[model samples]
Target: MLVVIGRIGRAHGIRGELAVDLRTDEPERRFAPGSSVVCAGRSLTVKAARPHSGKLLVTFDQVADRTAAEHLRGQVIEADVDPAELPEDDDAFYDHQLIGLRVARRDGAHVGEVTGVLHLPAHDTLAIDAEGREILVPFVAALVPEVDIERRVLVVADVPGLLDPDAAETVTPPEGR
Candidate 1:
């Protein structure tokens, strides 16, 4: 399986260094020297990398000079990972691990099945397919308290209107004269 680690930004200098917009939490491990990544259907080896501003300036052995780096701009960098590999953090889960999992309420009521995982600027969200309808739920500890991979179930908090919009209480305005 392949996971996105970063996106190639603009060329940093006259050299082959390119700024990278991080997508992964562990940048150090993913962008370390001698590490390998795939971009634009080509494998690239990390020659050097360093933190610049808020992004990482990385030089790839396959790219030479600013022209080569410019050609890689806007390309996404992906790394191959084992399917059975789990994140080091217990609370963290890969998108593949969550997809296809059965989503249910705390009371064991079935809500939906996870279709996809969206990585937004704020946080990760779960895209659920509920009876042919799409429902997006934030993947947070408060909302998603438990994720049982062995059982293939994701327990969601019973927040009003979260699972069912019609279940939420409606406010009625006072009668006018």
Candidate 2:
């Protein structure tokens, strides 16, 4: 399946190079020269790449000038990557993989189930289905310690203020169980 790798930014120079807002953490592997990428359902080849400031500057073989690069602005870059080739690390995960996983606290209290993953610049957020209420949990190390995908559970570290602080103080279990 194709995964979003980055988004085309503005044209960087008079050349075909365009600024890109990278989505993947491992750009060196995803956007390297000669890599094939898909954008707007069209295949494109990476001719060159360079780091500019905090963003990436890339040139595609089909794009010959600033005018060509201008047309690519805001287009999302995607790649058909094999999931197994992804970095062997616990922290790395695809957005779709986290969906529907049960979300619980370290104390074994059930909080909710992961419904979706929100991608933000600073960090990713987990959308939890909590008692019919949506709870957004920041997918960070300190708050989210473990992701047991095999058993389909996410272990969240105990942090009093991370959830609804005021409600947590007065929370009472529902009468059913």
Candidate 3:
């Protein structure tokens, strides 16, 4: 299956090279030269990919010059990857596997469904859509105790004020009329 590995940022220079914010842990291995990547729902061949500063400088076969590279800014880059090739450390879970899972409390109370995964600057968070309201819960072991991908169930630990929106609000006394 194809997984998002990076995003094409603004054009770096006038040589068709674009700045890429890599989302994967192994950027150098994934964005190697001659690698096939899918961007903007279209397959593109990577003509050259090299590290620059903290991000990657990439050039695609079809993209030429600054104008062409600028058009691809903010576009997500994906590539076909095997799930088994990923790291299997404890407390680590694949975002794709978490999608469509049923989220519930430790007491077996249904909370919501895992609609999507958000890759925040700090860490990954599970996007749960419960009764039309979106709830972002961190995928830490302290918050999420159990995750059964085969059964599509996730057991979340004690997370106060997560379900009630009003719990997050502060009440103020009304001014005397």
lDDT of 3 at 103: 87
Query: All candidates' TM-scores?
Result: 0.76, 0.75, 0.75
- List model 3 lDDT by residue over 70-100, tens digit each: 8898888888888765534555556777888
Report how far off residue 47 is in candidate 2 (Å).
1.4
lDDT of 2 by residue, 1-177 (tens): 677778888998899898988878789888889999998779999999989999999998888999988988888888887865654455787776788999888988998899997765566799999889888889998889999888999988767756565545556899998
Give all candidates' CA lDDT scores. 0.89, 0.84, 0.81
Candidates 2 and 3, the one with greater lDDT: 2
Off by over 4 Å in 2: 67-75, 83-86, 158-162, 165-177
Best by lDDT: 1
Per-residue error (Å), model 3, residue 77 = 0.6
Model 1 TM-score, 2 decimals: 0.76
Question: How many clashing residue pairs appear in each of the predictions shown?
Answer: 0, 0, 0
Rank candidates, lDDT, best first. 1, 2, 3
